[model samples]
Target: MDENYSLAVPFYDLWHEDGHVPLIRELLPPLLKGVERSVIEIGAGTGLVTRVIAQETPAEIYAVEPALGMRSVLVNRLAEDPELLRRVTVLPCGALDVEVDEPVEAIVMISVLQSFPAEQRAELWRVLARQLEPGGRLVFNWRERAVPVPGDLEVMGSYEVGRHTYEVAGQVLEVAGESVTSRFVYRIRQRGVVVSEDEAVVTNHWPAEERLVSELEAAGFSRDAAPEGMEVWRLP
Candidate 1:
């Protein structure tokens, strides 16, 4: 995978330590209350949200993450809690590809939707729709945008991840005699595990909230906006 993403595991842990866990813990319960008994978390990333869900709800939990590195961390983190471990199944696969033996009461995407390309996001929604039992719920969050539309949907909830401010000092001169300076902005991962510097390609698609509503409607869901940082779509 991408080295940058691979290196991100450590950074992701650090990011969560800074404050991501509390934010996720705060927003998760309301969504959890709407579901019945089972919950599947797509892109579970080291179980930050999973831990919260397990603690707050009585539902069974299944966490899916495609990255080996992140999965390892998740497994280790849940190792001590035999009951939670028994109730949870950590799979190494993306949400669009996983097969569940039984229908689920709810499917959560959390910070995962932004990581998908447009097509993947659509496919993921479709897959989740199929997995839902009648009246099942899908809950997820995205970065908020100042403009009605943003270049990257990932930037919408960007503040949750925290911002990086930095300065540049020296410049490099090319053979042509022009001096250039480079500046970069970084985002901190608030909760969950992230594989950075890996070969993985992380893309964000922020189709407007209306677009998401329309898509859910097309997929046979009635959508509602939740104040805790996500949109809730319930199967009709």
Candidate 2:
């Protein structure tokens, strides 16, 4: 998994260059109006959002990313701005394992929550509940699954055949004749050690607006609308 992520880091970094930074910049000010002291970003991939936070907010920023490949890019990008670099601390850790000596006023998750598995999503929220100061904000964004793609009959038949062969062989075998389906799998890690696997199937969950809201409530978060693609929660 680490190798796969490392290989994709460069592409991911490049993909964010096309106007994403400005988009985040425009959306952040309202949510961050009175926030001060310290702000921490979880899953700070390539520092796209980190750059904006450093520029627009006066608080000390801590960017936490578990992937070394992503962290390296962040370190390099912040190298030139000593003023920004002075207020920033880059941690090679994930949300679950990050320990800040001082309590933070706000925690930003950006597009990171979907990366946690269903079983751990609640626990992740519980961890956040502990880390954040009372009344502090927890902001995140999730890709909404709008419409469902019907199951392909042909693929289902092929999958059945593959299952039969695996049962007969008593060992896992890659079925060559089966149609391959690719989906994003979110995993959780602590300091480079994988703590959980296959946490969420990005495409299969939250297929509607109601489901998205319900999931947030179930995870102990009370959500309010944000500019179109984002959601903001005030921690209780």
Which has the greatest TM-score? 1
RMSD to the native, candidate 2?
11.9
TM-score of each: 0.74, 0.71
Alpha-carbon lDDT, every model = 0.66, 0.64
Q: How well is each residue in 39-154 modelled by candidate 2, as lDDT tens digits?
A: 99998888889887776679999898898888888888889788878988998887888788877888888766655655666677777767778777888765554343333222
- Per-residue error (Å), model 1, residue 61: 1.1
How many clashes does each candidate structure show, in the order listed?
Answer: 23, 1
Prediction 2 TM-score vs. true: 0.71
RMSD value for candidate 1: 9.1
Compute the lDDT of residue 19 as modeled in candidate 2: 37
Cα lDDT, model 2, residue 104:
83
